[model samples]
Target chain A: MLKIEGVSKLFNPGTVDEKIALLNANLHMKQGDFVTVIGSNGAGKSTLMNIISGVMKPDAGNIYIEGTEVSQLSEYSRSKWIGRVFQDPMAGTAPRMTIEENLAIAYKRGKPRGFSFGVNSKNRKVFREELSRLGIGLENRMTAKVGLLSGGERQALSLLMATFTRPQILLLDEHTAALDPARAELVTTLTENIVRELNLTTLMVTHNMEQAIRLGNRLIMMDKGKIILQVDEAQKQGLTVERLLGEFERISGKKMADDRVVLG
Target chain B: MLVSLVGAVELGLLYALMALGVYITFRILDFPDLTVDGSFTTGAAIGTVMTIAGSPPWLAVIFAFFGGAVAGTLTGLLHTKGKVNGLLSGIIMMIALYSINLRILGKPNVPLRGEANIFDGASVLTIGLILAVVAKIGLDLFFKTNLGLSLRATGDNSRMIRSFGANTDGTIIMGVALSNALVACSGALIAHSQNAANNSMGIGMIVIGLASVIIGEAIFGAKTIFRATLAVVLGAIIYRVIYALALRVEWLDAQDMKLITAVIIVGALVIPTIRRAIKSKSIAKKRTEEVLSSMGQTSGGGS
Candidate 1:
């Protein structure tokens, strides 16, 4: 479960280029709620995600994870309850480090890291089993540097690493956008399966309209720093791409102007 | 000739600790730390001052490591907490250390004459060898620990490590502190070995350390932490041996030692770039030739 109350973020405040990224945004999710977010660029989608993950703070607002106020916590401290897969696959994994070593870091997420050996027999077996589950044959290349893997493989690995520890909340920032269509589809399915297996409460920001509509129990759309629409699970099933754009036009009084929204 | 050869090896063994320190910051953390220039003298100053006050030689060297750690921690704090640039923090620390070292020594120079230096008894070369190997083994083991993995990850991809619940600022500080500690340890030994510590002994220390690290990686390859550390050790020895050999040139003056070091580092860095460029050029020419021949064949077919 997660809660955001009256969160507002302003960038370059008091400057000539002053911009409002998020304005009094409110979002809530119960246990195991999967919510997909979509918006135009600069629509404060990422700003909202960043606030929740503690990467950036809202100028005015409070965030609570499971009733614990965490607006004041640092990113690393808040990471105990939050797992993130960034848009850039390279951003989620160290290239020079081996696949197993990267997994070791993820396994100890939310736990105190210490002087213990990182890649011992016990953890190596766990990592191998988990990699095998990805069905990418990564189980056999535990010692290979992550840099050698393709973007799709890295994204798959990143998804596995983020959810393996079973964090309280999952944040995906267009995690599959960079992949080819087939790879994106593969990662998309994996994301759904892993979230279901772990029963994780997740907020996925996506550019693809169909993906936003197809996945998750609930959906929200943002425009001009505000959550303009929220559709529940039952309503989402009847919705199609044309109707979604119609809803966007009805709410914002403008067509989906961002080429990426229509293109995606 | 044999005596100078043995002496070069001895010097190499002592300075290898310094190179290992440089390796941690340079290769491991990807931080170009200038604290080496000051920390080396900080170690020598502390060791000499303590030895003058009647402490055992080895104890002085141990304290010197602590002194270097403190100095390095200062730079880390300046960079991480103070929000200063990485290079500037190192420069600031290196400059501040000069005054601090002078204060510790209470003079510009200190002599270890008639003192029971750690390398005084039995074979100095054996002492150097034991000290260097012990330090190398200790470093290699440290690199395998969980904390060490996080440290390496911080250098490689700090954002990824932070998302996995790590404070990169803490790891960077720890790395810099450990690096300078080893540098000071080497300085302590060198001061005792040569019977004196001078104010200018630390000049160009970073270059020498970088040279050693580069030479080692070039020869041994750095595919693994263990191999990399060994390369650093061997590189230090090789650099010193080459320095000795360069000095034997009849026309080369003693004053040219620094110049020789500078040239070696320049050559080491530039030669690789040059060779890679030439290799790429040859490949380009071959490709161009093939393209021209294909065009010729097409025209011949048309004719």
Candidate 2:
């Protein structure tokens, strides 16, 4: 379970380009809860994830995961408990490393990394089993360079790498946006299956309203750095795109003009 | 011709050290550290001066390494604390080092005669080559340490590195310091080996270092950190041998040396991409076969 209370982040606070990215944003998720977040451009969706991942500290807020306050912890320290996949497929993993090496780094997320000996039989077996479950036939190509993987394969591999250590929270920031539609679907389905199988708490940020509606048990809509719409399982399940847009218009007093959201 | 070949081998051993330094900053850390140009001169100047002042050759080399490391640390500090771009930081440090190097020797060049080096009247090439191998082994082992991991991770992803509770600034400092230290050490050895050190000798040194790294990566393949470093060392020696071979041709002259080095680097960068293209072509073939097999199974079952 995770709790974020009164978390506000301001970028370039006193500068000419000062923008309040997150204005008293608050989010709470129960254990094993999957939450989907939708927002237009500059909605602070990525900023919220960055706050949780410790990429950026909130200007004013407190974050608690399983009752442990982690707002003060650095990104690396928080990384042990937090797994994340970035929007750019190239950003999530090091390209030059082999599939197993990338997984090895992920596996040792917080642990001290050491000299390369041959990856032992036990570790190899574990990696193989984990890769096999993805059903992507990556187990055989453990030595293959991750750079060679297609966008979809890499994203899936990255997702697996992110969850390999079973972090306390998984953050997916437009993880499949770069992939082709078919590959995106494959990765998203894979994402749902993995989250369910692990019963992991997850926060997925998306531009697609349909994906935002269908994937997670909870749906939250945001605009101008504030969460204007929050829906639970019953409310979210009963919702459609039109109703969500109406709720957004009513709460934020602005029409959602982003074509990404409208067409998606 | 034999004397020239042997001389090239000796120079190659010394150059390997320079390449090692380049590998640390440029290859492993992915930093375009130009401190190498200044640090190399700083090392040679310090070593030559110290040797002329009746210091032991080994001690002089150590002092040179210290000088280079200090210069490297300055560059790292400028980049990390002062928030200077890596290339600019190196350039600034290198420019400052020119004056500092001149001050260290109190002259443009220093000449050494009857000095005690790590090698004596025997085959200097063999002795230097052995030393290069030992240094490479030692560096490979060093990179396996916790601090080394942090340094490497800093190069890989600074954000990811910072989140791990390690200070990226400290890691950069250590990496730059270590890289320049090695380069300066190489300069010291070169000064002693050649019996003279000139302040301007460091010019074009970074190019050679980069050439060695590229050549090594091309020949040995960069499978792991250890192999990568080792390849860099070997590449330095091989690069020298190749250069020596080129100069041995009756048609080539020392004046065209820079042109040859440039050609070598171009070759190093290209070979890897060519290999990748070939490998990917094969992978594509296998992929099509895999798709066909899977498709056949799925269609047969569904039909």
Candidate 3:
């Protein structure tokens, strides 16, 4: 459902402190393919997602969602087809807005947003029912500001919001990196459940190797902006964290030095 | 004293519009938009000029709103597409607007001789109060809308807003437009009320708007959306009353009006910080006491 061809990204071009983020990276995903991307710090995992989301433009690349070239689209324009959840739980939701209000924005995604009266009773009921599905009792607190929610609750709400309109592609950028272990597991489970239910073509960038193995149907490892190894359905079914790291070392010619990634 | 109080209320009503604008930019969008400095005068200049051109009063006010929106859009473009800092964009626009405002007015000031004002043919205080209520309710309802939710979300967390397939740039543009439109409307009303629009009138207008927002947030405790907006309106009136009353004081120097306004803003902003510090200290003290008491009990049991 999504195709990325020869994507190259360079930060601070022609400056003294310049770095090439992505170098000739290519990715292709089928419909309902949940691809988990694992990479170290500065591995261009987030950059790849950002490019797809239109947060940052690739220096040279052609990105197609359902065969439409979106590399040149602005973040606002690209947003119509892309849904994203960030590493920071606070990044994906407005703190001051109530649950219902945030959901309203999500519901009206890609639609013309002009002046209107207010959230009427009919919309309120729909919002309440939507919130109830999370099993967090958020439906009862529709009027509560999102700031009042805990990290897990907020992330769950964010995931729901990102997939509310069922975009062509969902980009998860370390979405559960900020939560506690128990909360992270809960949110991860929720993520798996939502992706499965919607059958969304998703790119989930994660540092947790275990989650990379456990959650998605396909797993890809990246080093220095290039895809080092990718596992398909048959191989991915029996993949382990240790074998993944072994493959990483063999392909990249370097051991994963980042303790956070190893420990995580 | 009563006359000054009434005049303060009138000023406060006009200021509520600017305060609302500031609330949107500084608080809601988390964008420090300085365009108000120029847009306020731009609105006044354009509205006063339109009135001079024999335009209908209501239409002149509407025109001023659109004028402010145009200026805001320029700032938005500079920030979004041009990747300019919001503050710098606003400042650049403000500088450019000063000249544009002058050109529109054709001079430093333009008098609205016999045109209808917001308070025209009505008791100034009565009309002012009514306008304040209308603006407050009108905006409260708007903020609850889908578009308004997106605007507020644009400031609170832009990433989430974008993920929803909403254009953050479009929201920013709409937000800036909405903010400056309110400010411009204020300028329009003020110009008509005072019967003249002066080039220097918008100086310190942003500070006043900030002061009102700060003061309102402090006084209103920012607990509810309705209360917060209402507090801002109240803060503007209160600030004006205090300013007017200070001017009437025999011992207070009238030249220090700006200084007094500055002090009020500083005081309002600092209150929250001070409260937070005091609360933290008290909590620390209580924790320390509990730890000491626990140690003492353990030693006593050991003995």
Candidate 4:
């Protein structure tokens, strides 16, 4: 359902601080494929996600969602086929807006937004039912500002918002990184349930090795702007953190020194 | 005193339109648009000129709104398309508007020369109240629409809204344009009431608008958009009343009005912080009492 071909991105091409964020990156995913990506700092994990989401265009190749090339599309235009959850809980939802208002916005994603009233009785009922599904009692406070919600609640709401329109692809950039342990677990469970229930084609970037291995049908390791390793579902069944570290050392010729990846 | 109070109410209602415009940019869009200082004058200039040119009063006022909207759109374009900073973009448009307003008026000021204006058919208070209520209701209705939700979201979180497939640039343009349009309308109304449009009439307009919004939100609270807009209107009236009362002092002169305006704004801005501090201190005192009472109960039980 998604194809990325030979994407390259060079930041500050000629300056002293020039860095090749992505080089000839290539990936393809089948429909309903949930893939987890893991990498250390500056491994171009976010750059790849940005390119796929059209937040930043790749300097050299084409990206196709359902066989239609979208490399030239603007971020807002490309968003018709893509849903994203950012790392910061505050980044994925508008704080001052009410829960129902935020959902109304997500419900109309990729659709024409015209003169219709935003939150009518019908949609308000729909939003109430949907919020109840979160099991967080948010339905009772539909008019409450999202800023009043906790980080985990906001992230869960963001996930629901992203999947409400059922985009062609969902990009999650370390979405649970900001929450406390219990909240993170709650969000992680919600993410799994929502992705499974919707059969969504998702690409999740994570710093946690166990989560990287435990979730997703496919796993990929990235380093220095390249996809260094890939493991299918069969291979991932027996994958261990130690083995993954060994593989990283063997291929990149450097120790995996990022404590976040190891400790997380 | 009674006549001054009535005059204050009329002036306050007229400036309420401008205050509402400021509320959109400053409170809703989180944009510090300096364009108000110029666009307010732009409305006055355009409306006054049109009135002098034999157009109907209502038509002239409507034209002034469109004129201000266009000026606001220019600022939005300069900011979004030209990649200029928001403050710089507004400043640039404001400076350009000075020359544009001059061209429209053909001079620094223009007198109506007893030309029939909107207030001629109605009392100033009645007309001002009607127009202000219409603008407020119109704004309230517009904000309930889908486009308005997107605009509010754009101000709250542009990146998130973009990810949801909304064009933030368009929303920004629309918001800034709408804000200035209302401001200019207020300017036109003021010009009609005063019987003249001066180039310097818009000076300190942003400050006054900000003061009204701050005072309104501080006194009345901004629980909802309706309340917020209502508070702004009330704040404008209260501000005018205070100005009128200050003017009654024998030592005060007309030139000191700007200083008074500044002081009023400062006082309004500090009120919230002061309230918070006082509440926190009271809470601390209560907490100490609770702790001491609990300790005394435990000691009595042990004895």
Candidate 5:
């Protein structure tokens, strides 16, 4: 469903504070592949996601989504095939907009927006039904400003929005990291349910090792701008946190130092 | 007093158009566009010049809107394409418009003492009311459209909207252009009603427009776009009424209007913060009472 070839990105090149974000990164995913990504801080995980989403162009790379090369497309253009949920709860939705209005925008994704009214009675009914599916009673608050929603509710709404138009790829960048444990669990469950039901090709970047291991068909570990380890379905079926840590130590020759990863 | 009130309402309605324009850029787009200060003059100058050249008053006003829209587009280009700072781009346009407005008029001012204007046959208040209502209704409808929602979303969160496949840069440009068009239309109407267009007439227009928007939102609330626009119009009228009343003071000169406008804007801006502070303070007091009462109840139960 997605392909990345020879991708490289350098931040502040030629500057004293230069850092290599991505280096010759290569990744591929089959249609409907649910892949979970795990890495420490500065592991180029976000850079990889950003490159795929066209938020920033790789210095040298070709990105193809559903067999179409979109490396040269602008972020908004590339968004036609990509749905993204950001790390910040506040980043995924417009705070001042209402639930139905937000859904209307998501519904128009990858489609031409013209003089037609964004939300009519018909769409409002659809949105209410969809919101009701989340089981959060958000259908009653279709006109409530999204800003008034809790972090968990907003993230869940964002998940619904990302899948509303059924993009070629869905990118989740620590989407539930800001929420409390219970809320995080709710969002994670919602994410799994939505992806599974739609059979969406999804790439979820997570700091939680258990989440990375427990969800998704495959798991990949990234470090120092490269995918250092990948666990296929066979290996992932028996994967454990201690074994993964041992594998990381054996491969990278360094202890897993990220506290969040360790705690998870 | 009655005549002053009537005049205030008339002028208020005229300025309400400009206030709505200001609301688009300031509140909707989250863009601090100073272009209105210049575009207002540009519209007035164009309208007067076109009218002097024997064009119909309505056509002249329409031309004025387009003229201002073009200026606004330039500002948008400077900010978006040229990668200039938004504030700096607006300032550049405002400075450039001074020369453009002077050239258009061929002088510092143009008097329409005997020329045909839209208000020549109609009462100024009636025409102003009609224009204001039309602009409000048009804006309310536009905001309900898909493009309009995208525009509002762009203002609310550019990155988020862009990820939804909306062209944010284009939306910003269109928004800024539309806003200035409205401002220019207001200026054209004012020029016709006042019987003259002066180069200096646009000075401090941004402040007045902002004042109207802030005052309107504070008093009328902005739960919806329609209500927000209505608030802006009412705010403009109230501002004009206050101006007229202030002029009635023996010590205040007509020239002090600008200072009074600044003061009104400051008051409007501060009112919200004051309200918030008072609300928080009352909440804190209520919490203290609750805590003390709970402690007293627990102590009494133990005793």
Candidate 6:
């Protein structure tokens, strides 16, 4: 379970270009509840995700994961309870490191990395099994540097790395946005499978309406630094792009601001 | 000639330890730690001062390593906590260490000519070889540890490592500490071998260390940890042999060695960049020609 209490983030507060990224926003999620978030550009979607993962601290507010206040914790400290996949493919994996080496680092997530040898027959076997599950032929090239992998393959690895350790919350920030259509579809399917297999409590940010409706138990729509609407599991089954857009225009009294949200 | 050759190998092996220290901060951590310029002297100062004070020379060597490690730790804190630039942090520590090294030495220089040392009546070459081998093997083993993997990841990608819940600050501090320890130990050994320590003895050490690493990686290739470390050790010896030959050049004074080292490093770094640029340009040209020819056929014209 995860809780965000009245979080507010201000960017360049007193500057001429000051912006209100997030204002008094609050969100809560139950365990194993995969919630897909769709929002226009500058909707503070990434900011919300970053604040939860401790990449950025809120100007005022507290975040609790499994009943522990992680507001004051550094990003690395909060990492114990959070796993993340960034929109940028390069953000989630070390390119110069080998495939197995990256997995070994993830395998010790939320635990103190100690003097034990990083990769052994035991962990290598685990890594091989996990990589094979991705069905990417990665198990055959455990020593190959991650830089050699394609974007889709890398995204799959990122998803696996974020989920395999089984953290309290998994944050995906437009993880498939950078991939081509086929790769994006592949990663989207992979994400659903891994989350279901692990029953992970995942919060994903996206611009894709179809993806938002097609996956996850619940969907939320945001605009202008606020969660304008949230569709529950029961309301989500009947959700369609036209209906959701109509609802957003009816509630906000304005057109959807982003073209990608319309097209995606 | 044979005596000079043996002497060169001995000096090379001794300096190899320092070079390995440089490789850690520079190659593994991707942090250009200028602390080497000061820590090397700090090690020699501690070793020589303690030896003169009648402490066991071996014990002095150990203390010297700690002294350098402390310097490295401060630099790490300055970078991670103080939010200073990595280069500036090392420079600040290197500058501060000059006074610290002087304090440890109690003077500008000290002679350990009559003092007992780890090399007392022992074969210098054998001792140097043993220490270098031990240091190399130790590093290879450390690289296999989980902590080591995180440290390597911190250098390769800090963001990625942080996502895995590893504290990069802790790893960086540990790595810099370990690197300077090796550097200081090498400094102590050099002091014992030379029978003295001077305030300026550590000057340009980063250049020398870098020269060894660059040369080693270029010649032997760093495809694996074991091969990379072995290359560094061999590179140090090769550097010293080249130094000996340079010393034999009547036109170049001993003071020219540092300048020569800087030039060598410049060449090593720039050569690859230039080669890559030319290679890439040629490849781009070839691709353009192929595309242009295909377009020429399809469009019935080439613009």
TM-score winner: 5
| Candidate 2 local lDDT, B133-209, one digit each (tens) | 87788787766555565566678766644544456787788889999999999998888888888889998899999
TM-score winner, 3 or 4: 4
- Candidate 4 chain A TM-score vs. reference chain A: 0.98
Q: What is the DockQ score, from 0 to 1, of model 2?
A: 0.22
Candidate 5, residue A75: how far the Cα is off, in Å: 0.5
Candidate 4 residue lDDT tens string, A1-264: 999999999999999999989989999999999999998789999999999988899899999999999998989988899999999999989999889889999988987788788999999998898888889999999999999999999999998999877898999999998888899899999899889988999999999898988889999999989998988889999998889888999999998867677444
Tell me the spans in candidate 2 whose CA falls farther than 4 Å from its real position: A11-18, A64-74, A114-122, A262-264, B45-63, B137-170, B215-231, B238-303
Model 3, residue A149: distance off in Å is 2.1
- Candidate achieving higher lDDT, 1 or 2: 1
Candidate 5 lDDT over B1-303, as tens digits, reads 999899999999999999999999999999999999999999999999999999999999999999999999999999989999999999999999999999999999799989999898889999999999999999999998899999999999999999999988899999999999999999999999899999999999999999999999999999989899999999999999999999999999899999999899889889899999999999999999999999999999999
Q: Tens digits of per-residue lDDT for model 5 on A154-251?
A: 99999999896789899999998889999999999999999998899999999898889999999998888988998988889999988988898999
Q: What's the TM-score of every candidate structure?
A: 0.96, 0.83, 0.92, 0.97, 0.98, 0.95
Model 3: CA > 4 A from native? A15-18, B112-118, B287-303
Q: Rate the local accuracy (lDDT) of all candidates.
A: 0.92, 0.84, 0.86, 0.92, 0.93, 0.90
| Residue A127 error, candidate 3, Å | 3.1
- lDDT string for model 3 (B1-303, tens) is 787788888889888988989988988888999999999999999888888787777789899999999999999999999999889999999999999989998888677777656556777667667777888888788888778887778888887777676778888998898899999989988898889998988988889899999998888767776888899998898999989888878888877988999999999989889999999999999999999999999999999
| Candidate 4 lDDT (Cα, 0 to 1) | 0.92
Worst 10 residues of 1 chain A by lDDT: A255-264
With a 3 Å backbone cut-off (N, CA, C), the pairs that clash in candidate 5 are none
C-alpha root-mean-square deviation, candidate 5 = 1.1
lDDT by residue for model 1 (A1-264), tens = 799999999999999999999999999999999999998878999899899998898899899999999998999989999999999989999898899989998988978888888889999999999999999999999999999999999999999999999999999999998888899999999999999999999999999998998899999999989999999989998989889889999999998877666334
> In model 1, where do residues sit more than 4 Å from their true spots?
A262-264, B279-303
For model 6, the stretches where C-alpha displacement exceeds 4 angstroms are A262-264, B276-303
Docking model 4 quality class: high
Per-residue lDDT over A129-152 for candidate 6, one digit per residue giving the tens place of the 0 to 100 score: 998988778899999989988988
How much of the true contact map at the interface does candidate 5 reproduce, as a fraction? Answer: 0.82
- lDDT string for model 3 (A42-146, tens) is 888989988888888889979998999989887877777778788898888888888888888887877777777337788788778777778889988988999
After superposing candidate 4, which stretches have Cα over 4 Å from the reference? A262-264, B288-303
